[model samples]
Target: MISRLLLFGATGDLAGRFLLPALARLSADGRVPDGLQVVGSAHQDWDDRTFRSHVATRLQQHAGDVPIEARDALISRLRYRAVDLEAAGSVAAAVGAFDDGGDAVDRPAVAVYLALPPVLFPAVLGALGGADLPVGSRIAVEKPFGTDLTSAVALNELLTRVTGGVEEAAFRVDHFLGMPKVQALLDRHAPGRPLTPVWNSASIAQVDVLWEETLGLGGRADFYDRTGAVRDVMQNHMLQVLTLVAMEPPARQTEGELHAAKLELLRSVRVCSAAEVPFRTRRARYAAGTLAEPGATGGRAVPGYSDEDGVDPARGTETYAELLLELDTPRWTGTRFVLRTGKALGTARKGVALHFRTAAPACDPGDAERVAADRLWIELDAPLESRQPGVQVTAPGERAAYGQVLTDLLSGGSRLSVSGEEAEQAWRIVDPVLQAWARNAVPLLEYPAGGAGPPPLEQTAGSARG
Candidate 1:
């Protein structure tokens, strides 16, 4: 167990909304040891008392459900320091203040959680490069790992060097995978399961991993304009969902086995070529319109995507992105995986849907059998109202997605964390599409908010710029 946690960016939005709340829940459950210490470092100049007060306010706002005593217990463990991320010495000094025990064998483990922005990863890792992190120490990093494949590779290499070539010490966190539903999906396809046998090309025809939302960018224009939809959703979150749905069942549920299976599946994803890009991908931005309320006729008006606050009209950044990907492995040779995400959609539908091949109906003398294709929907956002049975799973009561992530991180497990190679392979699969869209090789369509997204690929492919 980790005896101490060094939480970077403790005053940031992520820490207040997710990390602190998660830790508070664990504290409530008595999973947090009384002797455990938490060190919070950020640019804020607040002292320990002031930081605890701030934490109290944030916990009330975001984790009101957690008992007051638990919240207080967590706050009691927190100490604050103002550390300069850009300066390696400053970071090293702040972290170095927390001393490990006498020897490596008796030392209590210390874990570092980087809740800061991706741009600060290199600097923080560089600082830790010189800091004396005790043996068995771990580092948990947030996502948007890199802007592209090259950057991801470099970041991985830097992390490896920082940890003295121990890849397991660096945990690349993807909170989406920490959701109980996603974890259940992984367990659902374990060896000997009924679903495992039919989860392949022979039975399943196509898999759709979609993340559609009715909410527009909520004051994140500075980040959204640069990231757009593809990088924001598809490249990491959606691809991870795809791997969980389609990867071959691991020999066992061990972390190494699961990691190997996911990595192999990601490696099998065929990267789109220049020629295939046009027809295989689609991009669009939402136009000005009213967004309908859930299960109601009334709605609120929304501005067009490009007119949103802080967006660059000239960047041609897409608010909606779609990609049709294929795998070269025999298990999925003929199957397709469609990944899509959009903002300000008519409805919020986030989940993986598996479409199974239509089975031939029995011959009847006078009646003709009309059999529709079977679909198993693993609903994430809401329950579906389809004739076919759908599966909806939520995080085990009171445990949010980040809670599960922290559980794995603190326990020194990598099953829920993304590996370095997995991150690079995801970029490789989507890089071609991003490049094609950048060069204007693919046409950008306009779809109204509160309506269906851009037209199908076949309808727009002919109009793609040459």
Candidate 2:
């Protein structure tokens, strides 16, 4: 029922670039309601008119060489307010104009978006708790839901306590849930489909959720140093992706329906055995080096993660991490989950590779090279696949079986995708991982920049070749 979108951190990195323009494009397409109100908030002291200019700059940055029209029209929808997020009345200040009880058809409720840091969540919620808002007032929380399991649980409890309820009134999001390809993954694995029961079955040799980033910590070095790639990418992002790839088929297909399916997968996931987990997880810290430009220049010298603006000097934090996982359920007794992520990779892309058992035994001494493992790319994020026809058999990695599932989810909603509850469950699965890391969970596994993960991972990855 929320009609107005009050975007927190509206002037910051995300809003200044993607979110705002997405909303603008939606408006231009006439998809948004006529009275759809877009509000922006920040700690900087600025009037609405002044804030409008700040947002425009971000859009231009994302626009790149693409042409944009009627910039003012999109700008007209933006409203900004200066707020001290930590102060007592910050929530009320950010919740700019309000609409009294109005007809449902004429006006809708408020949608407050929390785009700032997790620490500020409590303050903002406290402010809203004291404010006089209606029952249907919905609020959104961003990623890195909590630093660790304890923090995540506390944050969830805090939001529920502050809001007095955590039902439809609160919404948690992962942009991947909005992708097209993700929806297809759901569609691919339905009740009677080959993908569902086979999702976790040994039928699949293994599943790899790969998240790669070309840019290292750079400006976020300090933040990246502490969180590392595990917390940054694998924990939240890939966890959700894995949930979809391995979960059971739900009775229904709505977000709520999908949530139930995902929860079962989380509950079934076998905790990585101490030995399997310890060495299975890999971390690499990118050192200063020059990277090849491919077609442009010979190469560019990029500072290692430690050189990032805000990163700690002696940080052993990894910009890249990989983990091997499995589920205890009957479906996937021995199937493994390989999670790999890095900031200083050669490219930027996010997707899952499902290496399936095309043959019964999975081994052929006669023609191991000729035999192929059907690997499908459930592209929830990037690095799409293309298989132009009339071509002969291609290698397992080179085949066009690459799919664009995530792309399908975006530009709209995807059924088998994660909802607030699913996202929370995914968080719960990582609770132990987070606690382990917070308490120096495992000895740090460090690797050089522009390379693969830690040296120990080479041994850990012995069984993950699938």
lDDT of predicted model 2: 0.61
What is candidate 1's lDDT per residue for 1-466, written digit by digit as tens? 7778899999998898788998999889887655878999999888999999999998997788899989988998889989999898888777765765575446676789999888889989988888877788889988888989999999999999888888789999888887766777776556665566676789877778989987677678888898889888788889999888888876677999888888999999988889888788989999998876544346667799889989998999998998888888888877878888998888778887777786522322321123344766666544232221221122342247888888788888887799999999999998888888899998888999989888755355543222
Please give the TM-score that candidate 1 achieves against the real structure: 0.89
Please give each candidate's TM-score.
0.89, 0.82
Q: Give a tens-digit lDDT track for model 2, residues 1-466.
A: 2357787788776565456656555554555555666778887888987888776776565443223653556688777777788775766756646555554334455677777776688778778777655555666676677776567777777667766774555555555555555545666666665445556555777777888765555466535666777777676768877877777767777656777777778777756544454556655567776554444354556776666677775656767767777787777777878778876655556677677777423222311122244766655544432232211221222111111111112223334233545555665566565455545656654444455445434355675433
Q: Give the per-residue Cα lDDT of candidate 1 at 378.
A: 69
Pairs clashing within candidate 1: none
Measured on C-alpha atoms, candidate 1 has an lDDT of 0.81
Instruction: List candidate 1 stretches off by more than 4 Å.
Output: 100-107, 293-297, 359-373, 381-399, 458-466
